[model samples]
Target chain A: MKRILLTLAVAGVLSSCGNNDTSKQAADQTETAHNATEHEEHGDHDGHGDHVASSVSGNTSVNGPVRKSDQASAILDGYLAMKDALASDNSAKAAASGEMMVKAFASFDRASLDPKQQASYDDTVDDAREHAEHIGTNSGKIDHQREHFDVLSKDMTDLIAVVGSDRTLYQDYCPMYNNKKGANWLSTSKEIKNPYMGSKMSTCGSMKTEIVPQ
Target chain B: MRWLKIAAVATVVVLVGIQWIPTPLNRGDTRADKDFIALYAPPARTGTLLKTACYDCHSNHTDYPWYSRFQPVAMFLGNHIEEGKKDLNLSEFGDYSPRRQRSKLKAMSSQIEDGAMPLTSYRLIHWNANLSKADEKAVLGWLKSEIK
Candidate 1:
């Protein structure tokens, strides 16, 4: 009887620990999802400066010199939204975010930048807009969207290089992507949550370059 | 002895038969005179190094080696050329968007720095294409100044 009671108690403790572990994992996933969705429904607004600024408002711009340009920052915001959506494997949201990117790029003012920056802006933004439209057009087709994202991420990195960014971003690369043809993208974090291979190879890429604002 | 004779005959026949198989060459009307090399107009020596190291696989015009006439090697070179061009084609460099050009340059820089490119198999065969340390520094340094 004593042994039976002891064994039952140990089993109860193990089960409770298992439940806690699962709950904690669920909570982490939810938090990550929430962070991604924070930019959701945000694409509808044209007030990109105010929107993008809010997310990256605090420490960097307060003390450090270089600030994100209004037009560039808005584009970055749209990219981040699409990237986060794809990272979470949300094709529907990825499409929506891609649409926002098209709108953001279309509405961006090029005349405001210097001649060199403007030239780069014109080319990179145009290329990125094409990829964004593809992603936007293919609402349920995540694989196709991912193919475009492969190049789009490279586009975004080049854009940020020319236009600069408020956020300290990392240029990440996944060697396993596109039959080892290799693909690259800009990420706001150093963590290896690959947008290219969602879930299957989520932690695939490594940070290759650090992009700190001017 | 009979089995060995049969195997030898089969190998010869297969090799001879495959010679008739047509392979696609990288040669195309899409070749650009205003290529990456042409655009930058690097020093003649630098240009030579680039041509030796890159253009064989990364250009629209791939000068076939003697072995490229062989069936399987021709096919292998064809595939490598296609993949290399897909990544960064000098002939199509002018056609790529500014972002793409920069990205390709960056890719080249990384590949060179990390020693991931010139693909060991390629370097083993095309010894002239091997990029020495000084060659790497000069080419990458020029690219860094240009890409930005």
Candidate 2:
């Protein structure tokens, strides 16, 4: 009887350890899901203003004028141009757009922005300029340019979060890029023309969220 | 007494039987030129620290322990390796874009400084993987310089 009881107890303890690991994994999954939902909600809130502006102006074009200053629009225009070029696998055009972005970022009017917005803009532009320079100078190295573009996309996302954009932008994610670490890029259309993979795996990504002009 | 003896034999049988259900190892034979070690070539000490502390999960090759050949434990480690590679693959570091390389370096520095890496569960088993203050400083210093 004693041996039987001990065997049952040992088995129970071992099984409980397996249960703990499963529960922990479940909790992690729930947390990730929660964070994704929160991100989507935040994007929707920022896009609300742009939705109102487009409706009021009766602008049927998705690229309607935004409430932001002209300087911000110029930066967004340059960024979108770069995004399109990268998608088309045109390194020379991407480099030109990158140079345009660098210029736009340099001349951006921060005086009109609030103190907090100024801080964010400064942080975003500083890194952005470096990435843009790398992209602009390495037109022959499309792979290198795409690598910088991946990071530049992130900087653009940060910029858009603060200043908003003149058009609705879809945030697309490619699971195959960056050694399967994945990468995100912004697009005007819902279709996934993966900027990271270009023509090689052009339709590899899926739209994660949409950023409406604020 | 007879029932207890039978149970013991059955348990041993189960343990030995499960060993044959091979868990796939993360070991990669080919050393890629794009490996993090090959790309930046950190000082010997810094390289050792990174290999010992981070590479098991963050790289394509894992120096698995002998006990890992056992059932359940091997699967557990295999899962961890898969998850870790999904976040960052140091073996494929050379393939990352310049911007990504910079950002990953920055992230490594921050994670080291914050002591969020070499995860608690991992450290519990692999004591040598624990980074002392000096190890942390050396790795962080190398990472800081590399990012620039």
Candidate 3:
């Protein structure tokens, strides 16, 4: 009877130890899961914080020193809206948006340009603006205008690629001032030049400029 | 299954036969009158990188892939090359005046920075053309230095 009692006591202790080990393992697993969740939450928080920091106010001017994100945003919005209008087959709206777009780009000061670039810049803008207006206003071939817009979009896309690489232009032209940096209209003298143009065209030697309001 | 087999055979036959079709390798009649050579004479390392990655299509001398001899694919490649070269030919880079060169350079940098050029689709097939963060920094660094 004594031995049986001893054996029963030992079995009870063993079963209790086994249950404790399982409980400890379960606790460790829960801790591990909690840690993983915490890490994920922390990562998400960091991402959100970055997004918040990079966010821009629409009306802000990107006039000198640091390029304002909002200026890029505004131009991008205008261009995209113009594209959207064209895509939707809204000729009047496209023309209007296109005019605004051209005007936005045209506001750059001519003095900033190297003489040849300046002259060419003016010519190209005039031609592009004229063609855009004609296409926008005249009902001759809306399809042709749309095609032209598509080509322009392509040219713009290609042009942007080159501009993105040319940070020098961004540094010199993207800002509102030069040496005499002070308050001025938010604009980018950042220009686009067509490298493929031969000498026959006057603007072929020039770059197109884009100017924006503060 | 029989129809599918016949269609597959027909497609293969047509594809093989197209290799014999002569395609015009038209090159632009680039003029020597412009300062084309002078401008591109001293290409920076960044310019070299751009040439390697983008100029295949954007320049006159497109390093055609061996497989470009095949039809449909060859035609598509030809069209891209022609259009790209038409848009911007680095071979004729020196022809533009300083202002034009500067603008073109700016446009080149802008396109790269914006993640637009060397289209992702093109890069998918040509893995070597893919730009890494380091490559981008190097290329943009050189381009940004040009404004002065």
Top candidate (TM-score): 1
What are the per-residue Cα lDDT tens digits for candidate 2 across B41-107? Answer: 9999999989999999999899988888898788889889998886578998876656556767866
The native-contact fractions of the candidates, in order shown, are: 0.31, 0.00, 0.00
For candidate 3 chain B, the 10 contiguous residues with the lowest summed lDDT are B33-42
Candidate 1 residue lDDT tens string, A1-214: 0000011111221222124477744543444334324433344121122122233323111222234544577778888888888888989999998999888887777777889878867887777887787689878878768877876886776576566677877666555565544456678886767788887767755554455664
The residue ranges of model 1 lying beyond 4 angstroms of the native Cα positions read A1-214, B30-33
Q: lDDT of each model, Cα atoms only? A: 0.68, 0.69, 0.45
Isolated chain A: TM-score per model?
Answer: 0.67, 0.67, 0.35
Candidate 3 residue-wise lDDT, A78-139, digit = tens: 45555545445556676676666666565535464457645644544443444355445544
Model 1 steric clash pairs:
none
Tens-place lDDT per residue, model 2, A1-214, is: 0000011121221222124477744543444344334444444322222222233234322333233334577777877888888888999999998899889887887887889888767767776777787688879777777766776787777677666667777666654565444466777886667787878767655555555554
Candidate 3, residue B97: CA error in Å?
5.2
Per-candidate TM-scores read 0.49, 0.46, 0.44
First chain TM-score, candidate 1: 0.67
The Cα RMSD across the true interface for model 1 is: 8.0
Q: How badly does each model clash, as a count of residue pairs? A: 0, 0, 25
